[model samples]
Target: MRLQGKTAIVTGAASGIGRATAVKFAREGAAVLTADLDDGATQDVVKEIETDGGTAYGIATDITVRANVDAMVAAAIGRFGKIDALVNNAGSRIIKSFLDHTEDDWRRMLDVNLTGHFLCCQAVLPHMLDAGVGRIINMASIAGNVGRPNRVGYVAAKGGLLAMTRALAADMAGKNITVNALAPGMIASPMNRGFKENDAFGENWNCENLARRWGEPEDVANVAAFLASDDAAFITGETVTVDGGSIAALVRQGE
Candidate 1:
């Protein structure tokens, strides 16, 4: 009930980390607006929240488009009367080697991962700014900080997202709007289906982290919930890494 009476808009709420965060927000008493490209999937999330005695709604949205982004914001405010938080959790990966990547790959990555965050923030910030308090949570990736194979474009987009999160926080300093990012490592979601299916890759991640286990979607969601709550009122311009201490550990093979 930390978020009681607050309203939150979560992008990419159809599945994976997005769905987990949206559900968690609702559970914490936020009136959640779950936005996703899939209408049916989004509705399912909405239903889940409702079944749990939480307030929520589903909107089919493509965050890369300005009109859709604006409409999503409008609908959220229209239903909830005001918007208090935004989780920029929508993004996809382009898993290709640097040489194999084309201009389209780069464009798509930035459009969905980076540009979408920009557009959503642009659409919702005026309301937050006017209210004099708000939370903007951006979903970044560990690849943004560390090198990853066959993910040049994804790395670039996530890196840009991290930088943008910092810039937004700096710009909003003393304005009561907090901007932050969550960088997750090896979350066991649909996004990492291939790795989960591969025994060697799965084992590597399972054993690399100090926790000796893969991170669940709820792990990141718990942190996001905290950032959205008053408990994190003074925390801004930070990128919290929730990776079971993998980012701090240097586990080498055969050593």
Candidate 2:
């Protein structure tokens, strides 16, 4: 009951980390708004929450579009009467070398991964400010912290997200709005399913991580729940790395 009576909106809630976070919020007594580009997929998540006796609603939202993002936020406010938390969980990745990436590919990746968070954050901030309390958790990646081959746009966008998170946190300090980024490393979400499918990719990913095993969606969800709760009130302008000690070892070795 950490989020009792709170209102939360989770983008990309149809699957993976987003879906897991939405369900986790609902279980903690929050009125969850689950949004995804796929309406049917979103509804399935809503149905699951309802079956578990939790309150949730589904909305088909294309986060890349400002109108869609605004409408999604509006719907959540309409349903719950206030916005308490916004999780910018929608993201995309295109595996291509910098030279191989086209203008369209770069734009698409930036739009969905970074710009989407911008639009959602802008849309939710007013309500959150009016309420004088809110949490904005932006999803980032370890790739943002370190260079990765074949993911130029993704790494760039996520790096920008981390910077934005810190900037917003500083700006919103006195407003009681905590803005932070969660940078997960090699989570076993649908977004990473392709790597799991390829033996070489999986092996490389495992070898890079100190845990030697992939992280689950729930692993990120657990951290999301903590960041969204009152316990994280004093924490802002920080990027919490939930990478199973991978980053620590990497930095240590590099030094």
Candidate 3:
């Protein structure tokens, strides 16, 4: 019961890492708020948590909208009493070269991936500050740390997210609030599966990843669970790489 009596809000909880984290939080004794654009899918996750004798609620929210984000934070507070943790997990990727990308494309990617987290954090931080303790985990990518081909917008947005995490951590250092980011490497999510089905992207991904295998959603959820727990009280302003050693290992000589 690492998170017993805590309330956690997980965005993009319709599927993949968000969904897994929502369930994990519930199982760890936190009352989970699963938010996503897909109402039906979110309800399914809520149902799953309830089936396991855990408490959860699902809300359909478009993170790109400031009003929606505000409403979401208010809903969590209204339902669960107070916000203890926030997992900014809603994001998307557009695989296109920088030269080929349009202004609209870049803005759209930033709106969802970067601006969404900003809005959510703004919406929840006041309450967290009032509570005197909180955890904020932003879902970034290793692509943000090192550039990847044909995903300029995603890389830029995630890089911004990483910087945001550090800045916020510094801003709230002694306020009992921790801000951190998770940089996952090639996790096998539905979005990545769609990209992998396309031969070109798949080949590029395989070549870049030294592990030669995709990471599971739980692989990330486990790390997230730890960060959300009190065990990571001393950890903040850091980006934890959950890439199965893909970024750490060196290239073989004759590969």
Candidate 4:
């Protein structure tokens, strides 16, 4: 297995892409520490992984809080003995227009999507540095790369994450640590179930992508496994888009 004997901490792992990544990491031979605010849900995920013969643990964590972030790091260290990778996947989005977005909305988006990732990175960096080898996968979005009309705060937060990925990669240069971001497309995760329910929204995304279908969380999770593995040792500061050609083709595949 690619991740044999490694340890990974995955945030927002209660569901969707986060849960998928945690399971994938564990299956690939990593001891996974899954963190999310939904304790029962995350515990369920760990149980499922354990049932499948994977090493996994779950913790209730609010990434927006520093104390919680500290506890998360400590839990991983205490349970797994060392940290090999950190996947900053915990995030939230508000579907409101730029004009309709309030200050509080903006703060909430930035707090969950950007600041939370920042805090987690800070808390885990020292341990990674101590180990002398690490991978940090920050979850970004295609909306950040291409502006989405109704999600101002989400776009801004993810854009900031993209920049932060590059900056941290530079900071970690020569330290045997790599920082990268994964820009997922319109994934068919529970987080986007609302959009999926809306015919117009779902149709538009499907039509926009060359794949002509919504992306599955596993699609992104597969890349997560690769990025967290040594196979990506030479990669850093890169944003790998898992949108199934949505960003590349200005013209839709069939259109």
Please, what is the TM-score per model? 0.97, 0.95, 0.94, 0.97
* Sort by TM-score, top down from the best: 1, 4, 2, 3
Q: How many Å off is the CA of 167 in candidate 2?
A: 0.7
Candidate 3 lDDT score at position 210 = 61
Clashes of 1: 0
Better model by lDDT: candidate 3 vs candidate 4: 4
Per-residue CA lDDT of model 3 for 12-106, tens digit only, reads 99999999999899989999999999999999999999999999999999999999998899899999999999999999899888899999999
Candidate topping lDDT = 4
Measured with C-alpha atoms, the lDDT of residue 28 in candidate 3 is 92
Give the C-alpha miss distance for residue 86 in model 2, angstroms.
0.3
Comparing 1 and 3 by TM-score, which wins?
1
Give candidates' CA RMSD values in order: 1.2, 2.4, 2.0, 1.3
* Total clashing pairs for each candidate: 0, 0, 0, 0
Sorted on lDDT, highest at the top, how do the candidates line up? 4, 1, 3, 2
Candidate 1 regions with alpha-carbon error over 4 angstroms: 203-206, 253-255
Q: After superposing candidate 2, which stretches have Cα over 4 Å from the reference?
A: 202-208, 251-255
Taking the tens digit of each residue's C-alpha lDDT, what string does model 1 give over 171-215? 998999999999999898888878887977764555578777888
